[model samples]
Target: MASMPGPTDAFARPLTDLRVSVTDRCNFRCRYCMPREIFGPDHAFLERDELLSFEEITRLVGLFTTLGVHKVRLTGGEPLLRSDLPTLIAGIAGLDRITDLALTTNGTLLPRHAADLAAAGLDRVTVSLDALDDEIHRAISDTRVPVTAVLAGIEAARAAGLPVKVNTVVKRGVNDDEITAMAAWGRREGITVRFIEYMDVGATNGWRLDDVVPAAEVVERLSTLGPLEPIGDGTPGGDVGDVQTGPGQVAERLRWSDGAGEVGVIASVTRPFCRTCSRARLSSVGELFTCLFATSGTDLRGPLRDGATDDEVVTIARDTWTHRTDRYSEERTAETARDDRVEMSYIGG
Candidate 1:
């Protein structure tokens, strides 16, 4: 048998997490990620051969584990939409070096698949839930998809014994009004809810700086409903911070937790955590993205399909990661001007 690979020759940034997009297809068309009208019938998605198969994904993941990545999150435009996803999950979970294996989905298909997914050894699940009210949810998602389905999906995942995190992208004048309601639902369900800033991820979203509902404002809005005392960060591996920067930032940190389940804000836009950003995204088509806002990615698929050894793939992945210096959020002004960035649906959130 081949000896295990050594420390990555060029890996840097203290990398520890990898997000793999299993498919580029989504059932819902969230305005920010993929507006429905634009993504209608004519838009071309990846063909069957373009996507990395389960075996190919496992090989890439094995190399990532060798390069000091310990956690992996399966994502997609909507991961659950992919058929037999649990089989893929089981394969990745079998990798002993991968301590954490989670998935992010739109929750439209989770109710039917949650149990199987948990049984397949997925460690955790996060579902995107934009609103509690069906009308508002339909508006936010830009589809007739009901909010009830997503809520039921969350309940199913919880019943399946999988820890669930509800993710909401709060856009000012849009879903921001639903923050408190969503938090109340989470508290009742005993699920951790994370509010994400409306990010300028892809050019298709028509991201406007005015649309961003700052993390500070989200906590304040929730605090008005009840006294939410700060608790420890729900997951240590979570990108959100547990520490307060100063008195000014303290309110933003503690105001939304009632000591039951915590509220997290991924301040990717307002508070850039680029220096500690240790994420690498593997697109469904086998390109590796160093940054979520990146316009281009190195094609690992070509090399892998060409019979490149694990060492060669590892070297390619390592070189791409080490020379990494992407802080799009910090340099938001400059990044906003670039036109060819990959859409969030293609890269997974």
Candidate 2:
């Protein structure tokens, strides 16, 4: 028999995806996330002892699978910054219940760790690169790391036989002009690209409603290549990363009508996906967050480290998830956007 839904929140949304933040330390202080003004030189990051050990993480992941999570993605302020990260990848890959395992990174480190990461059982990677132009890339990431570095990382991942996708956050008057350019690059490179609407993830990004380039317009601009078609069930070429569709899916995958290539868009701003949202974020220090815009999180680390039994810990997660009433995106307003929510860097994007 096929497996039934695991655990459902207040709205009956099943928990299927777990984004695990391996660490909170990042190399690049992207303006949208860990901006230099805030995460400047004087800022302090998590200590090694404070973060969940690989054993603790793997154990928690195992319990998550029992609660209906089959997809796991390793994330970070920059996951590659974590030392001996392949060890953690290897551990998560060993979990029998995990159907898919992926990671999101800045991609600068992939050139050095791609082969090792793939060899350790990483399934795929999604690199965060905003623009092809050096100036725009520099402005967005607030770093001198050239676009060439990210491109090199993509090549390295490909050579290691790991599927690669590029994620671009489109902020109006920012990188919005690069939508078609990005699609063209992906087509030329035979890679899948996903465009994300600039979201009010954290309070400090200075989010404005007008700054959001709607996903429809992004898709419209890309349609210039050729009319795009939604890549849904039974759609050919939809097998890219085996990306799913329907309820609880974030990215809406689409392919060129002429079949030249494929692309996707995440319209969280103009279109709220809260009704079927199924992702649970485990913070770098072990807080279990039920929503991306959550103001507070349930501290699983405290109880786990306090010697709670596996059953007890599992109960904590289940109860917290079951009682969750998060719909921040659906109810986003000028007011809600100002809520002091958790930073994307702390929980990974």
The number of the candidate with the highest lDDT is 2
Q: Flag regions of model 1 displaced more than 4 Å.
A: 1-12, 231-258, 334-338
Which candidate wins on TM-score? 2
- Candidate 1 residue pairs in clash (backbone atoms < 3 Å): none
Q: Local distance difference test, per candidate?
A: 0.79, 0.88
Candidate 1: residue 204 Cα off by (Å): 0.8
Model 1 worst lDDT run, 10 consecutive residues: 242-251
lDDT of 1 by residue, 198-269 (tens): 888888887877888998788778777677764434222332342222211211234343466667777877
Candidate 1: clashing residue pairs, number: 0
Residue 95, candidate 1: Cα error in Å is 0.7
Q: Candidate 1 deviates by what RMSD?
A: 4.1
Model 2 C-alpha lDDT per residue in residues 193-301, reported as the tens digit of each score: 9999999997788888899999989988998888887876523223445544445777888888777778998888887878878899999889999998888898889
